[model samples]
Target: MNQSQQPDAADPKRRDILRWTVGLSAGLVLAPLAGCDGGSDDSFSATVDTLPEAPRIVAKNGLIDIDLEAAYAHNSVQLAASAQNAYPGESTQQATDLRSYNGAMLAPTLQLNAGDTLRVLLHNKLPGNDTKYSSLPYLNYQNSTNLHFHGLHVNPGIIRPGVYGDYVVDTPDAGVVPGASRQHEIHLPADHTNGVYWYHPHLHGSTTTQVANGMFGAILVNTPRNDFDLPDDVRDRVIFVHRLNLSDGGRSDNLYDYVNNKNSAFMLNGVYQPTIVMRPGEIQNWHFLNSDVFYPFNPVLDEHTLWQYARDGNSFDRVFRPVNAATSVQMDGRHWPGNVLYPGNRSSVLVQASQTPGTYYLRAAKAPSSTGEEIVARIVVEGRPVEAALPSPHRLPLYNAHQPITDAELAQHGGKTRAVILAMLNKDSDLLVQPIPAGEEWFIPPGDGVSLTDTVFATGNVGTKLAPFQSDLAVTQTIALNAVEEWTLYNLNGYPHPFHIHVNDCYVVKVNGEDIEPYWADTIPLAPNGTSDQPTSITFRSRFTDFTGKFVWHCHALDHEDLGMMELVEVRT
Candidate 1:
């Protein structure tokens, strides 16, 4: 049943039951956590709707050191709501029914500086993967996993001896099989922007299957900034939106219908409807991550304005001091209403408490067709007021926000524009029955009298055709270093598909042929259009700069990528 159609809204008896299942029962979830001993611990207790902070790992002495294990653990905070997506009568997840990092449902938030080295001992403790599904073009190594720093400009290969970088396109250097250990050494560039990003397993074939079951965390990048950067413990809030796709028996293997289901319940830090308390006139740093496999979140703070500094971990030039005598700096970088965040995306913004002493809500709508908004978090602004100034990009010690690619930069590369298509197999557009395209997953039959033949999307490396992704596949795209190119992504699928690229952020030039103000983004949602002739297109300009080797761009819908919607690329001097 749809969440809006659930009986809890009208039936007071059901509402009482849901409240018990979702709110106070969360206390049972906080018992077994070991490393989550960080953050504030203030709550009303009787009705435990208060927002709980996730366990965190902080960088010390220029390095973030920790051990992260991937295994089946007992996370009591049931991600699925009883009436919305959970199994009937199941309030808490069954033992060993889910997988997570360090046996905790709330993945540890990694707090680090821009130039720090992250050394992690990743242990894979899951049992052997079912090799029956491991085949070419479409593989699901359900028990194997690896790490991908989603939006940081780090090296795509090894960082040092006995350590791996942000590379996940290769198998031997990437995935850690059961009973295996991999030392991950991710080195962020000295100029890496201070914003929000995330870490997740990016092993091919099993990427979506694992992520859909809850296996992701926030990567909060920080830098030295005066008067703006807030403390990590007191006020920084990480809202990770992910689903616990469960079977009827509460196992995490139920993949079908959950991603496409509009009424799926999204958990906030593994809990539902947690309260976020703030004082009047006080501003707190809030970062959001959409870790869901398929849906889009349009986040809105009721009657409050959000100062948006970055999107997808790329800082914007929008936050600045007034050029003219505009005292309020109105609407410059503020999301007065809300913004649409796609899956595998992290948004960094600042939210000030309402001046009025009252109750408000942090709500989100799953796409546009939902019956109404779901209250994700309750913001209680009824404490002593404190005056806090909004941050400006001009005051930061080292602020290198996005500088849009101009006409000159595009002309250097001869204004080359490339086009790629995203679509479903002609036989099936939905995964209700099973995962499609047992083999030849790259085949897209001629639609509307056209396909990616020799004339279009035909790069020399892959040779005049599109190919599904394999770790050892040849680089399909060889981009000239420092050259800026424009790419148009077309979505011919019936549902929305988020396009994401690693290593570099892009300038969003246009959406569906409308010219918008250019902004920096690492991910974008191609509008849905089922027809190939009139597909939805998004135009973005990317400048391959600094460091590069081998990386990938794919559908961030995850399952679509896992099922062969990814392409490999290389940047060379």
Candidate 2:
């Protein structure tokens, strides 16, 4: 029951139903109806049948088993910089054991047809690192991890539930936590969409550690049965983007320090040392995913339009949809056409063949700004047309416009909220001369300038030790906000820290609580530590209902969190 499958060209009635399904009822009507057919050759299908045939890779519908074995040493292999693996000369670091993979970790590009069953066997070899000592949400440290089939319409609770220590909504003995040597089955609905989906560890606390060890992969779905309606000229390629932050030692035996302080330096798949190269005049569709901590990878297209095909493996039929959180987006309305892939997420982008064949560079954009980084891949579109390329259904949906928040919405909430500052605690420096008495909430007075950075509150004691419940602000320990209070986060650090809260999908109420031109995110990217502002900030609103847990609010950067950058958030409902 693949949701992205189109109606049969021979059956007009089913075709109309599918059109309506892909348009208005993406989740409900389209999903269930597609599932009822049970991968049958019936009218209710989840693929397009009118296009050319897809190149065969694995079986149309089968399982791809991946295992993580512990390695005490390092492995070396030559990586391919070209599509056909012609120039495999560079020797790079490899995962010594099942527990790790590093220095350009590779995963097979999964290609499946609609109604295909994706059964995966994820084995965890390095045990006993669950939650007690690990920083990530522990599914089961003894043999914990998750297999979240990102963007697929399936039950997450049941798929690849690794061993459970914490961060699991489903308890063990319920089949959510896998015992040692046990394998879990993830069932994808027949009507699931044909876009770029992905798999990774979803164990709450331990996600950082597991993913850092190269425990992530990409999932690509072909149209109904992988044999239907695929264009000849363009072939789908799955590119898994990962950040390798390994220590000086070998990869396999190295401990996964979720709190690694260094920023990500390597891009595993297409942007690694040996960049991906493609033939000219041959259209290539790229499916990308960023398995980094929380940094957003924005790729650039200079000569090409970078036509988007899908997000999160699901096809977007209509011109508009709402993106309220960090999720997958399929640009093409179908599986054949590719789309744009965002950082910390997945996307399908199609690079059409160029009339003039030459080397074209694809670069990665830095987070929280428009600036891009080094080339990720090079397209030498010189070869003849491979096959009949399927036309990407590039309908500029209005929903895409609403994505990443708009300027007007940011302006409306700007200046309507109060500013809050983020700074580290050290003994001695108190420009405000405000002492943090024990057992009280802290509060720093907003300076007279439009931005918080302009206002100086604390200074000098970079060597001071912060007593418990003692902060630079006057309020001390508790951060109390009156009902309906709008707050703006004025990040004083120089490095990027993604700010996140529990329960509520926060709108970018304002940029620095004032109208400004900048990107908006649920996780505000703070400046790097030790750098002076150029202050960055964001505002958000909350109703404060039904979510009265001892939740946490902090920078999504795992290193920052371990260094006491996180705080307890108790929203009084």
Candidate 3:
């Protein structure tokens, strides 16, 4: 069977799986208030079992060379009982079980410098027949996978010709077929942002399944800027969060089963309620990566203020303390009292241990019932003070600080504006037959008798009929070299989506018509319409100053993206 052929959505065999997987009838609405519990309906009791802390592995040289081989593993988790009453018609308890992964439940951390080259040799050791339970009529290559360097400005593909041609940037084609292996080369520019980034499987059809099984890792790019200075005695920790729902036999029947049943365990660094010992008056830098396929978490450390200085690997001009911190001078529109980490987002926060020692809970203040307000980790401050004074916020050198795009530059070269609407199409939508824009090419999968809507499953371009990093489709939206362009991403979907662009970082200028502090980020959240009829929009500006090639823009909700919500853009010299 052709790998790119569109799956027959109407096939009787396909219907069984489609009914259980593809449809999400309602949109995810934002929960009111910061600490309110969004209640659950399972019957199994929550566990309190805890595991030993996992080791943090940092890269030795400038190169991040590693091998990722898929395999199965067992992990234990403890789900705490809810203090708030369960919502009507919701489950009161849910059981916990061990799940599988590529190796361990969580991959190791891959650390590097700003100007480093990442050479990864990923071996596809996953069983080729893992898709035997799949219901999709087309190729359900669950064992096939690839890697995406999230939030990195790196080349998507090597130069070649024709199908494997140079500058084509074939993102989907980069996948490693089952029983095969592939080498991925990524070069981070000399001035790449210095903070937290991540890597995960991006194979279109099996992305959710692979990531759900824990094929992810952290990539930290170090810098010498004083603004990001930390005390020599301070400990740096990576807290990678994931939500998993395993059955009695320690496996899920389908990729969407976790979504439908709401039986999940929220984990930090692959362990439940892992305890971290700290000294009173000591400060620590905690880097967080939200690798969940769909869930969003707003984290708060009780009685502790989070001094956030970075987002999506890009550091801000000044450190931002929570709005309620006593030392916080003033509140910037971009500053918040807590950190909200959506899917595909990364953040670094400075946490100071209380002067008086005690145990504190670091948990998500807001999350869905499957993993709502659960205690993620425990911080025990039982030792004497390591530092006499509390750490002060640092004013770091921002990325591209010397090449700030001024108003004059905008007026001169930022005239190009592109509008994008993120919407979902059904059987009744006109987009099913909408023609591609004049002179703009549409990516047709390798199969005959496939409709545009059918192509959505194959290419992930439902309402827009666009393809992932297809150079021809992006020609119409070509950006001139070194040009600063303003782009507005409107969310027409019923739920919120995180808009992410590759190869460039953007500063959010306005959201929902309200002016905001221009903060640099590679991923920005697009709010849902809510009760309003009009879709919410966010405007941002990005400078295409450096390298030119094909890259992609898409919803950071990996599931939404896999089902068709990505487009290609080109920077032409």
TM-score of each: 0.77, 0.52, 0.75
Any residue pairs clashing in model 1, and if so which? none
Computed on alpha carbons, the lDDT of every model, listed in order, comes to 0.62, 0.40, 0.56
Residue pairs in collision within model 3: 40-90, 40-91, 41-90, 41-91, 42-91, 160-165, 160-166, 161-165, 460-564
User: Residue 271's C-alpha lDDT in candidate 2?
Assistant: 37
lDDT per residue (tens digit) for residues 193-221 in model 3: 77788777766546766677667877667
Q: What is the C-alpha RMSD of each candidate to the true structure, in Å?
A: 10.9, 13.1, 13.8
For 1-573, candidate 2 gives per-residue lDDT tens digits of 432233321223543333222111112112111112215533222322111111112322233333333222244423322222112223354333324422224544344654555544444444454343322222124235444444443432333355321122322112224333434444444444455555555443344555666665555565321222444334445556555554334342212343332333435452343333434445566566666664555565547656554444434443222221122222211210112223344555666656665655555544342233544444444433344353536542223322443445435434244455555443233523445454332222233121212222221212332321123332222223223335566555654455554333344445543543222123444433323335555566543332233444555454333233444454442
RMSD of 3: 13.8
TM-score: which is higher, 1 or 2?
A: 1
Off by over 4 Å in 1: 1-49, 78-96, 133-140, 160-162, 171-174, 223-227, 230-234, 254-263, 320-338, 366-372, 389-401, 427-467, 470-475
Error of 1 at 509 (Å): 1.2
TM-score of 1: 0.77
Q: For every model in order, what is the number of clashing pairs?
A: 0, 89, 9
Error of 2 at 264 (Å): 8.2
The positional error of residue 544 in candidate 3, measured at the CA in angstroms, is: 2.3
lDDT against true structure, model 2: 0.40
